[model samples]
Target: MPRTTGIRALIRPLRQALRRRISRWITRCCGTPHPRTGPLPAPGRILVCQSNSRLGNTLLLIPLLQGLADRYPHARIDVVIKGCVHGSLLQSLPGIGHVHELPARGAAPRAMLKLIRELRRLHYDLAVEANSLSTTNRILLAGCGASHRLGFAGPDQCLRLTHAVALPSVASHSALQLLHLLTALPGRAPASQPTLAVYPDAPTRARAETRLRRALGSIPANRPVIGFFTRATGNKQLPNAWWQQWRAALHAGGDPPLLIEIVPPGGLPVHADQAAVSTTDLMELAALLARLDVFVSADCGPMHLAAAAGIPVVGLFRATPASRFAPLGNDCISLDEPLHPVVVARETVWRYDRRRDTRRSA
Candidate 1:
């Protein structure tokens, strides 16, 4: 019985993989093919497939949304994504007319079929596979049966794509790459710029302001408040001791800026300050981060979040390539490899000081 149980557990993953393969094959086989070779038709109802559920990916997706909206002022833009909560994450984001929640790969077939049915009911002028490498996104793009299909194509997806774009060999910002997809379309291309942004509604921003002031207590007008994110997923997280060293280095100058430790939902770790603020809401977190002078974190979603909030972000990259996932904007630092904690502290201080001086001069 024990051996049987163990084998069952081991084979569960294999079964799941087989299910996903079958599902992908089914998706690729579906859809009406209208292979266009020139400039795309002026789209009325468009679908964008970016099923990644992470905050960073959501933020990175904003530029493409903005560009699409700009290019087609009157087009109805619909986004197909993964999570139910993601609908709210994209709420009030300009240019997005609808958000479609799809079942993740290897999930129940019933839900997937229902989503596909709903999608087919609407006649889309275009469907886009936003991610260059997402086979699932390619499946959604092709299988959705739009007259035009666009994506950065590999060998598997190129034949299925109507507007197939070659994937860049060089590493570049994720946000920028998504924006580059617009260049593949017919007509004048949208200018490439960092458009990573999250809108905290007016009331939410006001509430966030009040909370931050209370948490911040009193400080001089010129003093910059530094927010430190101690947590990150995967191997990109900086150790608690490294944070300690970074903090010590910041204080070595005898003028320690106001440091606010940003805590996540679960619980605060040993390294976090006792008075640290915690919030699970992504937009609320962005609102809170907007109040900071400078935000620093490992190459995590919040680093991108802070950049989206229009603050100077110090993104410390340990495992991931900063070139690909680094925060995209002016005044953002993307430090890759062999990172010295003290050096990061110095750089953060320099950005804070530069901003303070600029504000004073203004």
Candidate 2:
């Protein structure tokens, strides 16, 4: 097993290098030649690359998308996302006019060729590598041949693009780092709040509610819905079990209030009085989160999704520091492990009350 593991590890770096090279070559081939004598042209069409695998990881790109939308409000924002995340993920964002799905989960050469052809046809004006600073994602963005290719400069980063942002120190959130790609542009500020537009239609809302009800029988709408996501065996796990406990206690302390959504190891089970939505699809998860009043999840993608949907997110952070990955919203709440239960309950109540007041004000 160790030998196989070592081989697998070795293969990844090698595969990444090859993918990065292919990405660089594709970008160079697709690049448009404009004279260096003038300033960059205004964005006519922009491609935001978010081909990352994990759902939570891709959600990190929301800030970049929002920032771009804010700066070039009129620019058509196109996202190049993996098929699993495309439909459910980018559809809700404010500026995302189109999402070009990259069919690359399986079948390498054919998929790569198809993606390259599709990009060639689009001929985007600017390409922002809003994904990870890894060699692969950077190279993929570089290959898009946008007039302005933006990414970070790592020590051995080979995918040479014209515009680049310096990688933030380890202390910065990965979401914030993705926004650095925007800093390379003029008249753009990185301080803008991250926004994700989740406008679920009546039909979608009904379907989601129906599914939740079917799974968790008869939940009271009057009760505050506290979501617990503990499937963190992999990348999806959050370390806020203690917070969930505190939330349960707080609810017990409340009057007729506290329905928890339990998503666990064997998948979401059928239960009464709560909603359970279990899917690997990032977009569906985001939509479900939009319906939630508050979500308590690990420091993973769903936490950000819940936060982006404007729901209050109580993100429990573990080995990965909460400082870097806290949900990016006023309503989003985060708690560190080993924290006092009173603090957790107080913060949850405060945010919940604040959300209620905001709705009342609105």
Candidate 3:
């Protein structure tokens, strides 16, 4: 067993070296340098590559998209993303012209070739790789044939980019890290606090309201509606018992707030008696989130969605740092340490009450 372990350890560095060599070869073949000294030209066609499939990462790109729109109002901004759900969410964002969905890894080679052809046909003036240090994303950016390519100045991928921003030595929020790419563009202003903005259409809002009415009965005019998200992607999930305790405590105070469980399409239901709403559609989910007075969720994609819809969110974090991944906006509260269910319930209620008071004062 010791011999086998030693052999495996020796093989790991060899594999990494081989991969790095191949990446460098590909970049040298496909990438060309554009001048970095002069002021950046106003691009007519822009391609933003964020090939990560995780929903949270995709949602975080909203601020970068907004930044690009502000910098170049006339550019036709296109995005190359990994999932159809991400494409749908981005479609409604202002200044987005097209959303190109990349086939998942191990998909048919023909599909990848077809996507490459389509990207080349656009003849993009500029391409920005939003991921910090992804070899695959770097390769895609190299092959995109954009006149100017922007990305981070990492050891592996810096040579592939025409203009690369030096990555910060200290850790920062993912949204702030992505905004670093914008600094490479000449004449672009410094990015403000990152916040996602999504606009759901009227028809989608009507449908979402109908679904909510069916599940939770009539909408209360005066009572605060609190939305709870129980499931997260993996180990981030909280136990059902934890939620049950919180729900019970929340109701113990005066008149109970209307609790709506927001479940993802294939996620487990919070409780048999709880009013749960599940949907695969992004806009419908956004529409539902927009109406909620407060949203309580784990550090998950839907948590970002609720924040984007301008709802106050109470984000519970256990595995990840709330400092880095907490929902944007002043209305968000992030609890990183373990707190009692009663405490969580009270804090959520207090946030809603404060919001109400502020609105009244306004």
Candidate 4:
């Protein structure tokens, strides 16, 4: 397992040295990037480098995208995303012009070089390094060759973050940190309320609902459907027995909510007393999640996706800290075990007004 803190500390000096080298090379390759010194004009073309390859990271970036769309309503935003599957993740998001799908981190040298050439072919008014703690992200920000570059300043990262904002004094989630980076611009302020968001179009919603109805058999007017995602990465994965225990407790509370398995990536439909739905299409999954009354899962991408879909979520936090990646929005809460299942059931039923928990009291 990668101990992130230890790795980051070990690589810090190497990162600094590489930054200096890249700084000099960028000046020669793309010419000197202009400093953000004068009255700012609205940028027409913007590039953001946040190539961290995780479904959760991709979803968490929505707030920053929301901020850019709001602040520069007319500008075009491009995201350089790593990983093959994630390239299309944000392609359809409003105000996004393009998604530059870079190969996964540590791709072939030729592919990386080709991507650099392609990026250098265009001119961007602004570029952003959206991560606070990534040497690769910073190097890509420099390579983008935008007229003005922005980032969160870490110790001695002046070469890349010519226009940088100091990280917030108080600790915050990674999503919030990215949003704060936008505030460094002149006459700019971060969104008052930042939430992860995904917009599923009408056809997509219709298709999702159709599939859901097939599984649900009958859509009752007064029932609460609770979603459960059974798998997570590494130690975050919860065993089937644990879920059985939770559900049993809920049943003991009487009028148990309908439990549906919301399968995660690389997971099969759980063979249990529940309906299961799985799809490769994220938006379709989001739409299906949206129709549900509430969602429950270990801290994972689908948990974030459910929050983006505007559903109430109960996120399980055992291996990961909920402080950074907990579902943010209305009626969302993060909990650590050993969660008293009876208490959880009671609270969920009460909050959702699940008097014997029906399919959403119409």
Among these predictions, the greatest lDDT belongs to 3
Whichever of 3 and 4 has more lDDT, that candidate is: 3
Worst 10 residues of 4 by lDDT: 30-39
TM-score of each prediction: 0.87, 0.78, 0.90, 0.85
lDDT of 4 by residue, 1-362 (tens): 77567788889889988877775566455432433333457999888888787889988888888788788899999988776566555876778988887766567878867777777777888888876566567667767778888876544353444466777654477788788877678766787567877788899999999988887778776667788887888888778777777777767755666778877556666665578877888889989999988888889988898998888888888888787788977778888877666666655666566423343343
Candidates ranked, most accurate by lDDT first: 3, 1, 4, 2
Weakest ten-residue segment in model 1 by summed lDDT = 27-36
Residues 1-362, model 2: lDDT tens digits: 13456678889889989876765565456432221222457797888877676666677777788788888888899887775544566667777788877666566767776676777688888887665444445645656667777666554345556666667777977777777767777774676455445555666667776766666567764455556565654533534555455655676664634445556435653333344556554445566677666776667666776777678887776667886788887567667766665666667667666766666788
Candidate 2, overall lDDT? 0.65
lDDT of each: 0.78, 0.65, 0.82, 0.76
TM-score of 1: 0.87
Residue-by-residue lDDT tens digits, candidate 1, 148-183: 877765433433666756665559778777777777
Cα deviation of 200 in candidate 3 (Å)?
A: 0.3
Off by over 4 Å in 3: 1-14, 17-38, 266-268, 359-362
Q: Among these predicted structures, which one has the highest TM-score? A: 3
> Higher-lDDT candidate among 1 and 3?
3
For each candidate in turn, give its C-alpha RMSD to the true structure in angstroms.
4.3, 5.2, 3.7, 4.7
Q: Which 10 successive residues of model 2 have the least lDDT summed?
A: 30-39
TM-score of 2: 0.78
